[model samples]
Target: MLNRKSFGFDWGQFITGILFLIAAFVVMRYPLATLKTVTFIFAVVAIIRGIAILAGYSTLRQLTGKLAWVSLLMGIFDLVIGV
Candidate 1:
């Protein structure tokens, strides 16, 4: 017989997802006041995403080979847009 373990819920991911939803609601409710804040948040997220992609370039390249360049380009584009 094989021992199987059930996967547990990720509390951190759940909490962060909930927080993102609340933030979206707040932005929708008060667009004018939150416009700048929302943009800043977006820029930060883009920058972080770009960094993560670049950091994982090696693994991604191994997985996708020729297609990895597209991901790299996307990361660069994101970094540029974020800045």
Candidate 2:
């Protein structure tokens, strides 16, 4: 039975998977490298994502919407964890 409803996948998952692979390889290969560099990148990413989520909240009217809420929560969580 084909319902009228539909679901979509996010491109972010693929990008994140690729990034994780790259990060793992880089970290493994350069274990002796400065930790500050990795921490800096993590911080930058978290900050940027947090800002993006905050901006999106204005356009996201429905708190029940999964994408809106998930994005906002993930952004805040990432920022906290990153810091």
Candidate 3:
């Protein structure tokens, strides 16, 4: 016989596992769509990161001297690529 501590009905884990299984099935059936969605999210994040880096350019410059210019360019490139 199992003890209550080890064999109780864990509703939270059960629901999470079920949802994970559903996601797995969908991913298997429509891999391209999932990839596209994930890519789009990454692009949005890149754009946000670019803006963030640009906003902090002065501090970055103070810390890294001339190397900051490379970061500024990278930020601009990110914004362009994301769009």
* lDDT leader: 1
RMSD of each: 5.6, 4.9, 14.1
Ranking by TM-score: 1, 3, 2
How many angstroms is residue 51 displaced in model 3 relative to the true structure, after the best TM-score fit?
A: 0.9
Candidate 2 deviant stretches above 4 angstroms: 1-17, 62-83
Per model, state how many residue pairs clash.
Answer: 0, 0, 0
TM-score of each: 0.66, 0.48, 0.57
Cα error, candidate 2, residue 37 (Å): 3.2
Q: After superposition, how far is residue 56 of candidate 3 from its true place, in Å?
A: 1.5
- The superposed Cα distance between candidate 3 and the true structure at residue 47, in angstroms, equals 0.3
Quote the positional error of residue 21 for candidate 3 in Å. Answer: 16
| Global Cα lDDT for candidate 1 | 0.74
Q: What is the lDDT of every predicted structure here?
A: 0.74, 0.64, 0.72
lDDT of 3 by residue, 1-83 (tens): 33435755755345545655665666788887877655665566667767877887998799789899998998899898888
Ranking by lDDT: 1, 3, 2
Residue 4 of model 3 has an lDDT of: 39
Tens digit of per-residue lDDT, candidate 2, span 21-82:
66677788888763755676566566666665667675674644656777778778877866
Among residues 3 or more apart in sequence or in different chains, the pairs in candidate 3 whose N, CA or C atoms overlap within 3 Å are none
